[model samples]
Target: MKRSVLKFGGSSVSDFSKIKDLADYLKSRINKNEQLIVVVSAMGKTTDDLLTSVSHLTANPNDKDLAMLLNTGEQQTISFLSLALNDLDVRTKPLTGYQAGIETRGHHLKSKISSIESDFLENLFESNDLLIVAGFQGFNEVGELTTLGRGGSDTTAVALAAALNCTCEIYTDVTGVFSTDPRIYSNAKRWEMISFEEMMEMSALGAGVLETRSVELANNHNIPIYLGKTLSDEKGTWIVPNDQMLERKAVTGVALDKEMAHVTITYPLDSKTFLTDLFYKLEGAEINIDMISQIQNQEGLQLSFTVKESEEKDLNYLFDVLRESYTNLYVKIETTYCKLSVIGAGMRDMTGVASKIFKTLLTSDIPFYQVTTSEISVSYVVDENYGEKAARLLCEAFDL
Candidate 1:
């Protein structure tokens, strides 16, 4: 039988009414000859609510315990969804991440999938027309429950699709991928189709339509993903291989990442050892550095890099450790900054894209703190106040 995987986000299964509506959608998609797997996230803000409740119990709970608590959210969805589908006379079964044969590696709350048993899943489909698998979770070697980080449900869905050799569809709140976030830019154009490469870049740059890891997995495995709104009939966006892209705009989209903080360290010019040690320590701590710059001055060589705001707690402790070794080290952190980026595959051979970006911002008097570029992307770090204007002006300049 031809099989397919469909992933619904938290918003899609937020309540009983939504789950009932989803049951109808699944029945419409199911046929006697084809088997299907449906993956789902925790209903609405259940996961977040669980976390908030945890904070009230204890500021720092054990990671294992946290995973155990959070996994229940998805578990509830599967049980409720399974019941709804059964009420509709659809043969369905609810499976946890482990029961579905997903094995994971890495620590709790941020696990990476190690492997999946395809035969087990194939066997389950023999009798049941549809299997409702919980998303964003898996079991480790020690048999402890672990959750994938934010947007892990998307990753879970894509991984399952790759393993089963089936097409993957993601249903979310948005109708399609826009040239920019519609919430920020109301006039942003919606894309019918986007290249995998472009979509991956945008996802990483904070497009939020799809998780970056999910895009990477889909691109690597030659899987195409369809993203659309739940309970809507509008045609959504398709993320396919580059060769399949229909709109080849030079500037595909403008993306903004607000959860960013810039860290600048002024170290002595002769302190090469200090610079090396800092990076080595960051690597060991699993800190991701983005948009780095270095400049030599009469006093010292100043180093600057951006990291997710969530890392501030780790960085603070690391700085305390470093001060013991280098007493003269000077550091500054700006939490009031946002990273803005422009991405497109067409920019690979295009000239003057960077110049146009700088000119546009310069003319608008939006001063950027740091700038970085890739084959198909250019990023700027600007004050939070200027982020919206920068995106709007750049979108207009590129005619995105």
Candidate 2:
């Protein structure tokens, strides 16, 4: 029997009515005899609400307890969706990560899925049942419960798709990944197909379609990805493996991440020592760094990195730590910084693509304060003042 993994985000399964509607859609497919593995995220705002509760209730919420608390969001979702499916006369079972046989490498909040055993799932599929599993959280070999950090649902869907060797159907509020965040970029359109590498870069640069880690796992496993809207029939984009013959556009899409925050560190003493110390502090704060750069010309190691703006408080805490050891390790914070990325597979061999992108900026010419790149992505930073304008120009230039 053919099987497909469908992942619905919080917005898609936000309410009881939405769950009922999703159940109806699943019944149609379930009746068709397609073995369906439905991965569901916490209902809309549940995770956020959980966070708010933790902050107010406990000064230092234990990780074990916090995991227990945060996981309720998804628990509520999958079980309810399962019941709704059952009401439709479709056989269904709601399984938590531990119950679903997802084994992971004990990383707690950011666990890596080690493997998924299908012995338990075989009977479920044999019975023509719908397996609705909790997204994001998993259990390790020793039975330690772990969650997939931030966009856990996306990661959960991708991981299950790879393990099941099935097509991943990602159902979200948006019809698929867009050329840009439609809310921000008025001209932002959708792509019919995008490569895994390009999608990875997009996710890193704040592409909303799929998480970078999830895209990576899917790519490595040769799982085909489909993005779609939950309430509509509009076809979402397909993220294909790099091994395939990808039909590339001059530019697949342009994306901007407002969450970007910039940190500049200048060392007045030994740079290497200070560099090591600074990274230690960032690690302790659990801040993820991106687009890092270092410059040396007697300016004492000047280093800059981008992180999420939500880390503003965390970065402030980090600065306090740096202020302790290095008296002259001057730091500058820029809250109005954002990253703009142009993605494409054709860009690999295309000369002047970067220049064309930088040149098109002439009309708006948002001064390039910083730059970064990967084989599939070319990114730059701009004052938040001009961030959207830059995104729109790149979108128009790429004809997205």
Candidate 3:
């Protein structure tokens, strides 16, 4: 029998009532000849609450212990969901990431799935009509538990679908992907179909509906992902290959990432090792750097870049260490900035797109800093206060 993989986010299975409702929905979808695998995230706010509690014990908890603690949230979800399904007279089994054989690599709390052992999962499917697997947490090569970073559950679900050679359905609170966040702009249009390339651009640029890595994995394996609201009959969105699209818009969507900080450094040293040593330190810390600009003149070297505001503490610590060597390193961090981006596959064949963007912002007297571009996207950093207004203006200009 063929199998299908479905993933429900934290909000969909947040409580007992929701879990029961989801169980009924799953029962309705069960096919006599097909097996089902359900992957679920921790219930709403459980992971956050766990982190808050851990902070009470120690401000800086070890990554391994944090993973062990945070994983209980998903463990709670799987067991509760299994009980709910069995109570409905459905044959169900619950499994943790380790028990399900999801092997991962990388640092704890941000590990990536290296491989999945499907033999055990296939065996479990023989006597069970459904299997509930915890999402976001997996075991690494050293047999230590690790958690994937934010939106890891989405990655877990898509990875499972790829491994099993099955289609994936992701159920969340929203109906589907929108041209822009509906909360920010009321007229944001919902998309019925989006290409994997476009979706990957959107996610990486802070669309937030699906994690970037998950969409990348799905694209590599040619797995189409269905996204919709849980237990709702409303039409949803399908993420498919680019060739499946009938037409591409000049601009499809807009994304805003408010959690941004701009960092500038003026180093007085002209040593050749300055840039190399600085970047090597950042790489070892796993800090993602974006929008880098470097200039060398009579004033040693002036470097500017953007990074997530969430890494501010780490950036400060790293810079403090660097100061020990480069005593005259002048660093400035501005946290009042947000990154705004427009994405569309149609941009590849289009001209004047960037000009239009600059014109809109300039005419509105909204100042933007650090402009960057990809084949399908153009991003600008603007004051956080102007983020929503800039997004609305761009949406109207592009008719997104």
Question: Using TM-score as the measure, which candidate wins?
Answer: 3
Q: What's the best-to-worst order under TM-score?
A: 3, 1, 2
Better of 1 and 3 by lDDT: 3
Give, for candidate 2, the lowest lDDT window spanning 10 residues: 242-251
User: For each candidate, what is the lDDT?
Assistant: 0.90, 0.82, 0.92
Error of 3 at 133 (Å): 0.9
**Local accuracy of candidate 2 as per-residue lDDT tens digits, 326-399:** 88878888888888888887877777789888788876657878888777788888888888888887887777
Best by lDDT: 3
Cα RMSD, each candidate? 1.9, 2.3, 1.2
Global fold similarity of model 1 (TM-score): 0.94
Candidate 3 lDDT tens digits, 217-286 = 9999999999999999999999999899999999999999988899999997784687788899898878
State in Å the error of residue 322, model 2.
Answer: 4.9
- Per-candidate TM-scores read 0.94, 0.92, 0.97
The residue pairs in collision within model 3 are none
Model 3 residue 15 lDDT score? 87
